[model samples]
Target chain A: MKLQVAIDRVDIPRAVEIIRQVAGTADVIEVGTSLTKEFGVRALGPLIEAADGTAVLGDIKTCDEGKYEFDLGFDCGFAYLTVMGSSSLGTLEVCYASAETHDGVMMIDLLECDEDRIEKISGFENAVYCLHTSIDSGATADPVGQVRAFKAKYPQIRRIAIAGGIKKDQLAGLAAEGVEITIMGSAITKADDIAAACAECKGLCG
Target chain B: MKLQVAIDRVDIPRAVEIIRQVAGTADVIEVGTSLTKEFGVRALGPLIEAADGTAVLGDIKTCDEGKYEFDLGFDCGFAYLTVMGSSSLGTLEVCYASAETHDGVMMIDLLECDEDRIEKISGFENAVYCLHTSIDSGATADPVGQVRAFKAKYPQIRRIAIAGGIKKDQLAGLAAEGVEITIMGSAITKADDIAAACAECKGLCG
Candidate 1:
């Protein structure tokens, strides 16, 4: 499973420092929605450069004007961009097409999406379906079981990612459950020893 | 009736210029979703400032992490911020509470949100319930009729804003229909004389 470390709620300079520190450790480094909303895409050029070859996923959470958002995100050097699963099917289709055209990945954030909605949008083969539990709702009680059940229900959605308060101890179970990417936020970045915590999580998951 | 002119699909520099040109004409100057995804919120700061003491609204379209997105958007001087009506009740609650605490307004973008979802989230009295049509899906065919139907269905939702390709011709009808805010995009911003067009639309609505 790939490890995506989401850096959020921090200032730009501090974020750049964190990006440099965790560059080699993270398979995918996410400039969270907070940063995207706070700094704008062009300001993130330094962080993208700090990626040093790793994938930079901008958690844009685009809900409308998909082509414009996707095109701009790619231009700003985002290897991956996200669109909400709860967005209109038309918006999602545009985002999927934009991602495909740009040779960039699209991750569908299933924050509040229901099965009916998910079923309608399950056709994006190259897209990663994220079972994202909202921070406001707290962490998922049974993430591994959640992934297992999600995969079982939507067998065709081949690419799966799990996020929301993913702790270090849960990596093996998530990896075993066939989650392609496990997103960790405070679990690594907010830790006292960010690099050490990241290394520990990486060792366990990798 | 109030005029909310949306600045969309332009680079940050151009958006700044457009906002400055229309600053006093429109009641609400919207930094549209397209602008939010392009230059980002940081780049939007000057545009926010360009509103010339008029209220600025960032179409941030928060689907999740309500507090983070709302806080950042409000911090960036948006008098109002938007949350997707399709997000979970939990997410909406967080956004509403945050908006309330910050003395900011919440505009619920009801794009593709079902009747059931709308029924569940109707109680935020302070929020401007926006009946939004996706640009990706083309403009609303009959915006006046659409608003009338929505008002007939949910009279409890006191404040109403209508968006998606709202032209100058429709402003009188929307105003007659008791629409609080009429969001016009290319009709004004992409006009031969942008500021004059904005003033005309404002005159028609106001």
Candidate 2:
């Protein structure tokens, strides 16, 4: 139901510019994994500042040393941080605890994870289980269908988010399906008018 | 057998100092995942310079967007970069290609992968399949046994590496088992005399 605009593969100055353009329209602005890995979480203060009062999520995609990575991201002013679902249960638990302690949210990226793995990592009441498709693997075909299936399989997971090449046309379906967050990367960020594109996407999500 | 000293949870200055201390003794000096996430790969030029041709590896741990992350890491002058085995096969393939194109090595970090997943991702001839134990999952109780079992199951994988709380006492067994690379973290980097500890571990590997 919320539009999350992801800014990626750009320098901090450009990322800050994009954040400023979309801050009023986007409910959440994601500092993509590329930015986090390229600039480090500590260096993202400018983008965070540009977001003003809008929520910011850092797609750190933590695979190990969860507490350290999560603490660092939260300390850097990220309201939401991501951890890989493929990480060990202990890693997931520590990340969840860190999020709770920091009063932030945790989004578990379910990229390349099977049902068995997902079933085991469920039950984090506050955690958002993201049904993500890998960029290399191409765009997700049917996000609405994917969310329907995921919800059916793991009905206990309350907070659901979907990401990977999300377009404006699919935002309504995702919102109708009750997806908590719909992440759009290049579609909104690379548009001719960044602010206009984000406003349209935000309107669609409603 | 080779001794790969991992430098983690430290700042750039301290990392450079540790690299200087262990450069002569360590076959490979790993700029640990913590450093890469905290400082970014581009900012590791000093650490790479400190290695002085001891073969520095950036534990970039590419999970998705493999080509971009791999290219960024390899371009940053890392002789080696890591990709997560839990990543999609497509991601793994792109990472492998990037490593090959960059004339660098790719180390697959098998942190929480199962047999079925491993079987699907094997056969990157130049890749070092690292049998890694999650730091959150406690230290590997028997690394030798773990390597032996891995080899028995996947003999096609020729280049093998092992990591996670590796101690001086276990180096001999790992060497005898013909592990290609043994990654030691705090045991070597956190020692009172980092250079001396690295020398002892390298001697044991031989």
Candidate 3:
């Protein structure tokens, strides 16, 4: 399991500082959707520089213009970029192709999507199908259970990631459930000792 | 009928120039999703300034963090911001509230949404329910037919907007269908003479 630490709602300099502290500990450093929308992907030179060889995932949450967003995100130094599962099939198809062309990763954010919708969008073999709980809707009470059911429902989806208010204590259970990536935001970044918290979560994932 | 010219896939300087030219011709000037993602809404000061008094609609297409996105967009001088109809019910609620609080407009992007979904999300009385055709899905063939069908299906939704490759010739038909806002992209912004194209479209809308 990979620990993807998400840095969100902070300015560029602060985000850079946090990324630098957690890059060595986290397998993938997520530039959260807020940062991408707030600062734009092109303006994240400092944040990208601080990743220090770790994968940087830009949560662009592309609902449309798939190829443009994917190409720009990858060009701006993101190893992975996210596209909304709610987007059109054509949009998803192009985004997946763009990811392949750039040799970058695509993560489909399955927020507010029903099982039927999920089943229909399951053809992206290379993309990570993220079982995300929306922030406004509140965190998932059972991250492990959510993953177990998602895996059973779409057993063909090999790469699974979970996000939304993920706490430190929930890390080990998600890791045990074989979730490919567990994304934590405020839990790790807002902790008193950000570095130690990230290290602990990484250790739990291991 | 209102002509909302969408400025997309262009950098800030070009966008500013386009807005300045069309500010008088168009009722609303949309800073498209591409520009918002590429240059951030906060950095659109020049475009907003050039709009003068024309309502600037930021196609933020916000799926979550409703209040945050809406507040920032309104503060950045956008009269309108978009929220995806595909977002969670909770997200829609907060976005509507944010719009009300900011005295701003919320345009709900109805991309890839089914009738049942639209039925459930049709309660926002003040919102403009935009029947958007995804760029990946290609241009809407019959803008008039699409709007007629949408209005017939959801009579409660009073404010209606339609977008996606809406051409100058199609403007009069869309206007006859009583579509409140007609969003044109490349047809206006990518024209040989942007100002003339926008004025012609505005004339057609009349």
Candidate 4:
């Protein structure tokens, strides 16, 4: 499993600093939704540059105007962008098309979406369907089991990712579950030794 | 009834220019989600200052990390910020609390939310429940009927706003249906005389 470290709720300079520390350890370094909302994608040039060679994911959490958001995020140097699964199918279609045009990845955040809604939105073959639990709702009780059930239900969806309070201890389990990416936020970014924490998580993923 | 003009898909200079042109004509000036995503809320200081006393509504479109988004948006001079009705109950609660603490307003964007979800989230007494049709899904079929049905189903939701391709012809009808705010995007902003179009909508609202 690839380790995606989400950097959020911090200022631009601090975000860049954190990226400089953990980018080498994370497979994909995510500029979280808070950073994008607080600093805007245009202002994230520095953060993108700070990512060095690591893939940068901008958690724009786009819900509408998919083409515009995805195009802008890609132009801003994000290798990946996110759209909400709760967005209209039309929005999702446009986002997937935009990502293909730009040769970038689109990660669908499946937060607050029901099975019926997910079933309707499950045909985006290239998009990574993320089983995300909201930060406000706290951590996922059993992320491994959640992934197992999601894969069992949507067997056709080959790419899968998971987020929400993921800890280092859970990395090996997520990897063993055949999850593609496991996103960690405070677990690594807020640690006393962020680089060390990220390395530990990466080691577990390997 | 009030007329809220949305400024979207434009740069900071153009957004500020549009604000200067119509700030006096419209009751509320919205910094649309496109601008917020492309430019970020922190970069909107000049636009906020240029509103010239008109209430600036930043469509931050908070889906999660509620307190951070709301606090940042409100602090950035938005009189109101938006949260998705599709968000978790915990997210909604935190957003409402943040709005109350900031002495600002929270507009719940019911874009793709169903009746069952709306029923569960209708309790934020101070929130303005916005009946939004996705721009990608095309304009609302019958906004007036939609509002009436929404009111009938959830009378407890007192404050109501509606958006998505609202045209000049629909303004008075929406007002007559007791819609609190009618949000117009390209209808007025893309008009030859934006200020005049806004005045015309405001006239209908009055």
Point to the candidate with the largest lDDT: 2
lDDT of 3: 0.91
For model 1, the superposed segments whose C-alpha errors exceed 4 Å read: none
What is the Cα-based lDDT of residue B105 in candidate 1?
A: 96
**Model 4 segments more than 4 A misplaced:** none
In terms of docking quality, model 2 is: high
For candidate 3 chain A, which ten residues in a row score worst on lDDT? A36-45
Estimate the TM-score for candidate 3: 0.99
Question: Which residue runs of candidate 2 sit more than 4 Å off their true CA positions?
Answer: none
lDDT of each: 0.89, 0.93, 0.91, 0.92
TM-score of chain B of each: 0.97, 0.98, 0.98, 0.98
Scored against the true structure, residue B194 in model 4 reaches a CA lDDT of 88
Q: After superposition, how far is residue B148 of candidate 4 from its true place, in Å?
A: 1.6
Candidate 4 C-alpha lDDT tens digits along A27-116: 999999988987789999999899998999999999999998999999989999999999999999999999999999999999999999
Could you give the C-alpha RMSD of every candidate to the true structure, in order shown?
1.5, 0.7, 0.8, 1.1
Candidate 1 structure quality by residue, lDDT tens digits, B58-176: 89888878887887778878999999998878889889988998999999999989999898899999999999888889998999999999999998989999998787788999999
* Reference-based TM-score of each model: 0.96, 0.99, 0.99, 0.98
Cα-based lDDT at residue B115, candidate 3: 98
CA lDDT, candidate 3, residue A116: 90
Predicted chain A of candidate 3: TM-score: 0.98
Which residue pairs does candidate 3 place in steric collision?
A: none
lDDT of 3 by residue, B43-132 (tens): 888898999999999999999888888888888889999999999999999999989998999999999999999999999999999999
Q: What order do you get sorting by DockQ, best first?
A: 4, 2, 3, 1
